[model samples]
Target: MSRAFTREVDDAPPPPILERAISSARNLVTPNGARQIEQAMETLDRQIEASGDSEALAALRRELRYWHARHARMEIVEPPEAPTIVTFGTHVTIKRGGEPKHLHIVGEDEADPAVGTIAWTSPLARALEGARPGDVVEFQAGGREEEILVLSVKGASQ
Candidate 1:
C-alpha cells in the first residue's frame, strides 16, 4: 500500500488547474498562495520518501519540488490603493468600442479575461490602471488601438 501510494505521488503532475492558478498567483506574489504551495510540497516530499522510490523518481520529485518553492519566492508587489483610480482588485466600469462592461483588475493568477477579470500585467489592465472616472484611455492590442472611457471605479468589496 505504501509503495503504491509513493509511486502515485511520484508520477502525478501537479494538478492542472491548481498549477495554472498557482503560476498566475506567483506572478502577483500572493502570500497566501505561496504558503499553500509550500505546504503542498512538504506533503509531496513526505510521500516520496515513504514510497522508497528509485533514484530517478526521487530526483524528479526533488527538482519539481524545488521549482515550485523557488517560484513561490518571486517578488510580487501589491497594487496601490486608488479609490478613484483603477488598480489591482479594483472593479471598474467602462465603455469600450461602444459597449459597456465591468472588469476586475486582478493579479495574473486571478485573471479570467473571458469573465472580465484581467491581469494587471495585461495590456488592457495596464492601460486601465491609475485611470479615474471620466478618463478616456486608448489601448493598442493586436495592431489596433481601442478606446475606452472609465465610467466608475469601486473597491472589490462593493
Candidate 2:
C-alpha cells in the first residue's frame, strides 16, 4: 500500500471555541459596588486556595479574570455632596403606574431590584436622573410606556 493511502486519518477537527464576551461600557461603580467586587475576589481567592479539581479551578480563574477587570476599572462615585437633585448614589421615590417605588441609583454590579436599588444606566434611573419632587418623567418598562412622578429626592443616606 502507498504511504499516502495507508496513513492514519484524524476523524474531525475540534469545534471552534467562542471567546467569552465582556462589557465595553465604562465600569462605573458605587462604593457598595466596589466593596462587593472586593468581597467576590476574596471569596474566589478562598475557593482557588481550596480547590484541587482542574476543571473547577479553570472556571474560578475565568471568574477571577472578570472580577480583576472590574476591579481595575472600578470608579467609586460617592453620593453627591448635596444630593439635592437626583444623581448617582441618590435615593429617590417615584410613583410609577400609580404605584410608589423607592430606589437608589447605584452601580450596575450593586443593582438589586428586590432590595430597591437600580443601576444608574437603567432606563428608569436615566429618566429620573435630573427630576425633582413632583416632576413627572416618562418611563418604558416591560413593554409598557408610562409616566413616573418623582415623589421625593433624598440624600444617599436615606
Candidate 3:
C-alpha cells in the first residue's frame, strides 16, 4: 500500500493517573470507622494484585494510596464511657420544629446523612458539641438559622 493512502496506528501509553486528594483536617475516626478503613485497604490490596490492565492498575493503586494514608493518620476517638453531652462518637437526638431527629456523630469516612449519621466536623455536629439535654443549638440551614433542641445524648454503640 502507498504510504499516502495508508493510515498509521498510534501506540502512545495512557496518561498518568492523578492521586486522590487527602483531607488536611485531623483524621479523627471512630472504632467502626477505623475498621472500615482497614477493610477498604485490604480489599484494594487484593484488587491491585489481580488487576491486569495498566490503566486499571493505576487507578487501583491511587485508591490504595488514599486508604493507606488515611489508615496511617487516623486518630481513634473512642466514645465517652458515660456521655452526658453531645460529642464525637456520640448519638444525639434533637427536636427541630417539634419533630425528633436522630444523628450519630462519626468520622468523616463513616458519615451517611441518609442513615442519620453526620461527620463530627459538620456544622450541625459542631453546633451540638458540648451541649447537654435541654440545650438549644443554633444551626444554619438553607441560609437561615434555626434552633435545635437537644433531647438526648449517649455514647454511640458499634
lDDT of 1 by residue, 31-111 (tens): 443554566677776777677656645564765666475565556544445587887667899999799999977655446
Deviation from native of the Cα of residue 25 in model 2, angstroms: 2.0
In model 2, where is the ten-residue run with the lowest total lDDT?
A: 11-20
lDDT by residue (tens digit), candidate 3, 1-158: 66787545444565688888888889999999999999999999999889898888888989989999999999999888679999898988999988999999999988999999999998889999999999988999999999999999887442
Question: Which RMSD values do the candidates have, in order?
Answer: 9.4, 3.9, 3.0
lDDT of the structure predicted as candidate 3 = 0.90
Off by over 4 Å in 3: 1-12
Model 2 C-alpha RMSD to native? 3.9
Task: List the lowest-lDDT window of 10 residues for candidate 3.
Answer: 6-15
Error of 2 at 143 (Å): 3.6
The CA root-mean-square deviation of candidate 1, after full C-alpha superposition on the true structure, stands at 9.4
Ranked candidates, highest lDDT first: 3, 2, 1
Clash pairs, model 3 backbone: none
